[model samples]
Target chain A: MTTPTTGLPPEPAGRRSWLRDHSELGVCVMLLVLGALVLTDALTMDVDLTQRGPVGPRTVPVVVGAGLLVVAVLLAVDVVRGGRGRAETGEDVDLSEPADWRTVLLLTGVFLGSAVLIEPLGFPVSGALLFWGAAFALGSRRFDRDPLIAATVSLVAHTVFDNLLGVPLPGGPLMGVL
Target chain B: MNALTSLLDGFGTALTPINLLWAAIGVLLGTAIGVLPGIGPAMAVALLLPVTYGLEPIGAFIMFAGIYYGAMFGGSTTSILLNTPGESAAVVAAMEGNPMAKSGRGAQALAAAAIGHFAGGMVGTVLLVALAPAVAGLAVDIGAPDYFAIMVLAFIAVTSVLGSSRIRGLASLLIGLTIGLVGLDRMTGQQRLTFGSLQLADGIDVVIVAVGLFAIGEALWVAAHLRRGPPEPIPVGLPWLSRGDVRRTWKSWARGPFIGFPFGAIPAGGAEIPTFLSYVTEKRLSRHQEEWGKGAIEGVAGPESAASASAAGTLVTMLTLGLPTTAVAAVMLAAFQQYGIQPGPLLFEREPDLVWGLIASLFVGMVLLLALNLPLAPVWAKLLRIPRPYLYAGILFFASIGAYAVGGEVIDLVILLIIGLIGFGMRRYGLPVLPAIVAVILGPAAEQQLRRALQISDGSVSGLVGTPFSVTVYAVIVLLLAWPLLKKAVTRRRAEH
Candidate 1:
């Protein structure tokens, strides 16, 4: 039978190994790791007599840690029982297409690159690169138009946010040149 | 009568030229972004939240009220023409409106939706004006225990009511709670998960969590599966209803608010259920049974009204109890907290101008929406033709600006990217993002309330259930948890018969 709830195409029975089928196990593992980290942190935390109530700072974290562990186990059980989650759908999302990892990776790299360079290169130069990089990653190939638009977008953002809105942004080598 | 006078005074405040200008700008920007595929009202508000940093609290909230309502109004345009819902609440509108568009009645469908939205929004705001004060009046007596119980109910309700799997929902919530656990504990000032970072001591900013999750996460997710080529929007002439169309839709519009407003006021009672209920109710009452699945005006009319009305209803809970039942409400609540304005019973007395003006501005926003957007439908529809690359790139660009603008530090941007990845993972794994956001917003508050409750009773658990209100809330929570089992048992019994 087709998985109506999950909106996934029906899988061939016994064609793939069970391990491959249960890719969601990764999520469970992540949850378990997080739970352990929280538990370790909460357990090791020092509590002086500053706490007035029986429910001190550690209580909520401990409870939350236990909850994460419980939820991880429960989710693992559900996944093994042939349950599947329906990936989120949106207006731009095409569920029929396999995820484009290259684009996601490129976008991530661009984002991180901007974050690293924002302070040193300033918002205008870095942000312009960020916009162009993201557009290229998303498949905009108009080399002539894209950079022009990106530079314009970055400058406009700088002007509005820095000058108009009065929220300061670093200008770097081009400081006061604009 | 008191609410009426207060509302009138609110109108006086909202009508000031500066406040009106902000409202108009909010409506314009909100609708423009809301019309874009993959961006909903919540994302619009979250992306715009940082820009309001320089404004006073009153203007910011007034603008938010405009944005909130304006986005809902804009969502239907995309739903009707593009056959893609801007948000979950607009799904019902797309069901019939898309069919109507396919049948070459796109304008009629849009007219019905727009007018129906106006009618429902008006009713919901009136009810909000009337009911919010009464609810807040009663809420004044609610102790920390009762508040804690309500928060628990909200958490459980959001988890249980949404998504197919309870395990995934709970897991998402736990992740949010863990994130919320970072920073110095409210009571003892001891770090729970800060890991000795100076920035972590103050905790992750709600602006980061909000923009990172809603805006940046959405941008990344869309980038991964970006649809090739521009969407083909159904062309429509100016939206104008004939006499027959209005005659058909007015009844549904009238009936929709009654169905939508009460549902909106309740905790975790989002627009989805009420809109669905309105659609079903209209289908049942209509004489055109054959058109049930086809392009039915009543179908669009009812659900559109319900959705708008529920938006107002969601605000009721947000204003009266400081509880947010929908994603948009949650982000708006964060916006309130950003300004150090705690919305609840006391807000009515403390910030009457801000509160009342915000409520009155909802009406002003509706007028602006109908007056401007009705003729501007084609302009909004054209927004869909913008290439997916620039749309998503703009989102990331603005998100980065918003995040960095918050603290003027690179660390905030790093945190933003990390949260964006988690958000992307949540979507990939079919985890509902709403619970996570609500948890992030309410987690620390709920923990504080829980501790205070226990402290009042000297660490006895009975303090949690001491009040009748809290006790009743606990009973509801129990019922919410047991519902799935109850439903399964009923189905099995029926099968045996």
Candidate 2:
């Protein structure tokens, strides 16, 4: 489960075992960075003296940033001392198993693909691709039947939104026809 | 001006032919989505917000009321038949409901759950109508200092009560506040965290955060450990139970509203704690001890009712004070905001017809839910067998559509993807997502009220505790945060003996 999911280079052997165990320190680092960024932005903010009051807009951010720094330090200490969150078992989920990365990557690509093409291809076409790609990612092996169903679903969704619901979803090349 | 008179007038609007039609459509759509795994009412409302954008505020909200109850109604079906409760509130139901289904008593379990929802929803609505106006009347006197005090209490209690740990909960809240701070400052019109991005200056929409967290985030997590093979859905028959089953359920159903209402009425309103408490209560008071683990009808009736009743209790705070204690309420708040409306105490005096109509519709929606869902239980159960991949993929498709349709900008989709990833990471690390959502919706409001109180006091910090109400609220907040830890320490020490 601790497998590097972001397609990063594998960790060096032996020296970083402790870091692997306390991988949540990565969250600590992110929080600290965020806090520092907020603090720097707030401190460097130029306030007009004429407009300034008792509590400027920077006050809450400064307090929040400081609070975040304290929390990040506390969380890091806790993680280094072997504190860890228990896996959620309340649902039917089995969290101990490694993720099916192939499927996840495929689904991610499908969403990003639809996002990139939504303007150029329109709802009917891009939506069909999204639905088909998602179906393929989810292990539907019937290439012949799945895309047809995906198109039907996409067209129906498009008609419902664009025509019936009056949301004016773009139709791309089919803009005039739709 | 009386509550009863206002409610009767509200019925005048809700019972109209067109409004009735909208209510019907809302429930049908709501139940369909709720029957799907991991899609709760909040996600349903956000995804469907665009569909109802053209309707009048009353009609839209009437539909929203229907959808709200319908989600609770459908969530129980998934729990009883699939053993995969879609909402956290229904997790308790899955315990006995799944066992009942395995024993070929699936129909009885579904009936108990549906009927229990009906009973609880009606009782909860009655309580809401009776209690809300009075509370709003009292809340009219609550100044900004008291309001700020209560918001602080809500922040502390919600984070501590719901999450796996207080540390993670606070982190989630701070992150929400940070995300909320991205837009222009409310008082001074200055950018705090936009990072010089023109698109982000308008702020990330609450609907995006909601759908991204509950719908998209859950999708990603489920995608990682994608369950292989088809889930065997329990085949449900006609919805009915034996006389003995009915007899056994009555007492638990009666006890449900009693145990559920007070816990839900409190400031930290949610279905989770009360539903669990009612489950424990029913367990302790059950006649058949052997049936506790196997399949108890009481188990289904009590928790489902508690969940629905808690939902009703949440409305007390949501409607009367404009405080949203749960994620669903927060999105509903956004809905109210979308129509250029706010739901503070003035809402009652200014929009009596709308408020009472919505309340009246809650009663109407409850009856409609039982009548509509009871017969359709078997059909709804078949939806559980939808291919996991396609079903979840369908959810993502709808999520993107909902996000993009909100503003007709591709930038919203980008925000959706970013927030969805953050949501996935939050869940992966065992942080509760609800607080972040609650904080996002409430943080700006909290800040506004805090600044108002201070401005009124001319920078005197002591003005925050100027009133008895504010002082009492702060004291309760301290107790609420400390009592659980104190109890745990005492219990641990005693156990060492």
- Name the top lDDT candidate: 1
**Per-residue error at B254 for model 2, in Å?**
1.4
**lDDT (Cα, tens digit) per residue for candidate 2, span B336-395:** 877878898889999988898888888888888888888888789887777776777788
Per-residue lDDT of model 1, residues B1-497, tens digit only: 38888999999999999999989989988888888888999999999888767778878888888888788878888988988785778899999999999998998998899888889999999899989999999998998999899899889988888777788889989988998999999888898798999999989988899999998888898888887775699988888888988888899999999888888877654788899999999999998889877899999999999888998999989998999998889999998988888888888888888889999999998888788888998898888788888889989999999899888989999999999999998888888888888999999999999999999999999999999999999999999999999999999999999
DockQ of 2: 0.42
Clashing pairs in 1: none
DockQ of each: 0.67, 0.42
Looking at model 2 chain A, which ten-residue stretch has the lowest summed lDDT?
A1-10
RMSD of 2: 3.4
In angstroms, how far off is B285's CA in candidate 2?
Answer: 2.3
lDDT of 1 by residue, A1-178 (tens): 1143443554568446556678888899999999999999999988866678889898888999999999999888878767777788888888779889999999999999998998888999899999999999999999989999999999999998888777778887766575
**Cα-lDDT of candidate 1:** 0.88
Q: In candidate 1, which residue ranges exceed 4 Å CA deviation? A: A1-17
